[model samples]
Target chain A: MNSSSISNYINTLFPQFEPALREKLIEQVTIKDFKAGEHLMQTGQYFRSTVLIVEGRVKLYREGTDGNEFFMYYLQPGEACALSMICAAKQESSKIMGKAIEDSTILMVPITLMDDLMKQYPSWYYFVMETYRSRFEELLLVIDSIAFNGLDQRLSFYLQKQQEQLQTNELQLTHQEIASDLNSSREVISRLLKKMEQKGEIKLYRNFIELKK
Target chain B: MNSSSISNYINTLFPQFEPALREKLIEQVTIKDFKAGEHLMQTGQYFRSTVLIVEGRVKLYREGTDGNEFFMYYLQPGEACALSMICAAKQESSKIMGKAIEDSTILMVPITLMDDLMKQYPSWYYFVMETYRSRFEELLLVIDSIAFNGLDQRLSFYLQKQQEQLQTNELQLTHQEIASDLNSSREVISRLLKKMEQKGEIKLYRNFIELKK
Candidate 1:
């Protein structure tokens, strides 16, 4: 009875999923929700299920030694958390963290059924591979940004990414927020922002920065 | 005839692989060799097969904008290149670079058989998942080092990693080499090494740094 609602969510959110695989998920999966600003997963926590996002957004980041959040990537609706899948499969603790940037829903597929799904559903296996590949590539890009670029260049890339990901010219982030994400000081980020503003690349407002198109 | 040699190598290096799975690989996979310092995969290059190391070591790193290489992790015998598996499956170009740190032999498994192997062999599927999980975890650790720690701490961690991975107290790398790997200036690294020497952690020499017992 409750599964019917799950089936609806799965069908709408993951239209590309094979019918048989969706049916399998509906039979075995449970729904979980997180409010905005909630921590969905924390460092060193073990997950019992493979998580599939159904609605809203989840932000993934690494927790620094002093608990500062270093932004990594985002999880949108109709996607899976690659770390959850891997950690669940291996029964390992997570080293990173996941938080709900917006109220979000996810399908919790039990780790017990993972091997069976991989064997029985080709689409499921492909999805798993694709998720790993995409997240792996994202990490490589992050490494490249930090390894190759200076603070100014990294700021530029980060803003560009946020602009593209958020789909808006107005980025609702504070100088301190950007500083924490980039593991720099607020003063440094503010100075960089001022430089950008002077260069006509951005316009700073009270609560948001307008990216000049 | 050629397959028998491959079979022997597979058996010796990866005994944990299921017998049937190893047989399938011997029948279908081809062996490729890389001399030390040779590039196996470069930025934007596409791979024809998933690479599994059978002998020696591969160093995986990110290529910076100015072509500086930032070390990520090492791949030793009996392990598969997780990115190779992903890119080969997706028909995508590699974002990271791989080089033979030691003269290496690898088995190249054609992408066409990846699906069949996953479905037919449970152990093979597990290996694939394990490969992805391990590499993903390594990347997270790399992120943590760069994002959270200072240059001195990172260097300490790097030298410790080198000692562990090489199974020796003597590290045969120059300051310039270590600087390139850590994406830092040679002067800074040399100063840090001198500091470490003052503290009796390691002894600086012409071509190598020897750890104090």
Candidate 2:
């Protein structure tokens, strides 16, 4: 285990911070690294601190009654892990899991510290409110997609979003992962991919697929 | 129109002092009344204010690409109309129409004034935050229902929710409206209703259906 400059990186997200305040926040945050497949928090755990991804990727998922995992979304660099969970701490039963997709380091700050920061720093309060608002809007858009769009359309939308977010035309993703996000079976996804390929919508490659214009 | 004691009534939803601050909010709000089947806001116009239902009921709905209107949910007394619109004001297009379900009176609070309240009052800030959270969570549950739950189960859940929210066994709903909410066709909903009737799950009445426990 090694100490990292994660706090310095976190200050970059709060670019409006004065030098003195930035130093204080950096001193306050604690950074931790986890290996891939490690669960940061699971159902029934008390998460008193909110975590920000300093490096690497994390995925948040919910397990259904039959043990099927539903993809809520992924936490990328600069994104907070479960902002909603931190704000509304009343959820006794955790419906989602934050799993590291890669070797990841995150900066954590206590909620009480956050409260003090909001009061003492009005600009910081605006930043926190904006962060929550963005996530809230994203969740609503996801709900709209689920309500209005079909399975294939959702799969297409997800792929498009991932490609844009990752800045790559091709992704090294498995059918099972796609199925998890789409809330369908791997076999169904395989068939759909085949159909999509046949229609010249996408080109399937080894461990990746390229979208067609 | 004669001025109604709407502010006195809205105070019931909040604590005493908080409602006094909200009464100041009333001056900034316009009291608008509508009959059943009247539109408060439509798809093309910019929605500038969040309406509070002081009396009667309202429904929030959007149209599909096929020009079919999908009723999302009903807003009861003391609830906000199209609250997501308030949170995400960046939307260039209106997705839903707030229609009065019956003879309804609504207090329209402009977005700027609501933002002011959110800044001045921590209690109102928490209230708005919780309101958005509830709406977002409700939508997530809806997504879960659409993806995993069977059609019959979904229909049962919808009926149960309406019963609880509306506080009535009988719902004055049309088949087309039910189909839109369930994301199915009228024919499918009709068939399911017949099947439920045979199984004693629900009793169909004139202009309404009763969910049998």
Candidate 3:
């Protein structure tokens, strides 16, 4: 996309930005594209720039010390990873992993400009605060699910969230993948899937799960 | 405390604030005192103002639907609740609870000034983002504990954190309180404590736990 197109897209999301400030943002940001199944970021890595997802989806997950992965949330168009912004501001390393689940376009704003943007633009400050607020609330919900909800309920919630992100009831995932995301073993996930299938909640295929209407 | 003393205290924590901004913050913020065991905030309640703890400690906990409380973290004298800031900024209600664990003094900044402060003060904006980032990371750690660590290990980690916060190896809490914080039964916590005591890790008492040297 051209610079004007990028500026227009940003303005659409944050209409409060003035022309001059918007132009400055457009000038400072660089656009990058990632193919499907690409690692946008990894654990223990520092983010040189904060990313704004201009197009497509990004999956964020937390990796445990033993290499177990648990699904955290997704970043859609118009959303940025709050953790990335936080780490960028603090000059710290990320503890979570981010991957593009599909072909994605992201606007990269260098860390050097973040402070200036916040200081100069009220809209940018609001955007940053709102991002942090929403992400903080999301993390709380994730904790609630793991702390209070049963594994089966968490699995169902995970599938529902995934379907919503993918915009389809049919999910292209193996039981093992589901198990890994939920931090459960494949045998346990298979047993739960069998029970779910028996109850007609989902139809399990060789490598996919179809949520019944 | 006097206004100048409060300003001095805030300056100690956030020295980046300009003298003018610091004076503005001091002028706008009202200091409120809380008795030990007072509720600073509760679940599902709206935050009318953001609080900065000027003295003593605050215990932050998440309440489950059934009213079971899980301890999330603590807010020391220098810190503020990031959720309160977020909720205040967005005009949203809080999902967790906060209580003054000891006699405490807090500076309450009205929600009306939040935007103006962000617009006028770079230090305030940085403080807000850093708060959100640290709290977000804390929530992730909570999730890691629940998802990866066993209950016994979580209990141990909990005790260690409590001891660190209280600045005493002798924790002044009942087994029931510990169970409530960990979202387990008193019987379960008692059993685990008994095991830890046998292992010479802690000495259990009627209403307190003493960590061994």
TM-score of each: 0.97, 0.87, 0.93
Candidate 3 TM-score, true structure as reference: 0.93
Best-to-worst order by TM-score is 1, 3, 2
Instruction: Say which docking band candidate 2 falls in.
Output: acceptable
**CA-RMSD of model 2:** 3.0
Model 1, A1-213: lDDT tens digits are 377879999889877789988888999999988999999999999999999998888889899878788999889988899999999998999888899989998889999999888888878888888899889989988988887888998999999999988899999999998998898999999999999999999999988999998
Please list the residue runs of candidate 1 whose C-alpha ends up more than 4 Å from where it truly belongs after superposition.
Answer: A1-4
Please give the distance, in angstroms, between residue B208's alpha carbon in candidate 3 and its true position after superposition: 2.2
TM-score of the second chain, each candidate in turn, equals: 0.97, 0.86, 0.93
The i-RMS of every model, in angstroms, reads 0.8, 3.1, 1.0
lDDT per residue (tens digit) for residues B1-213 in model 2: 433465565567555337556767756667878998898777666667766777888877655555656556678776765453454344344656678878988777677665567556767666665565566556556656766778888898788888887899889888877897666898999889999999998898867998877
Is candidate 1 or 2 superior in lDDT? 1
Candidate 3, B48-154: lDDT as tens digits: 89989988899999988888788999998878889889999899999999888899889888999998888787778777877888888888889889988999999
Best by DockQ: 1
Q: Name the 10 consecutive residues with the lowest summed lDDT in model 3 chain A.
A: A8-17
Q: What lDDT is reached at residue A105 by model 1?
A: 87
**Residue A188 alpha-carbon offset, candidate 3, angstroms:** 1.6
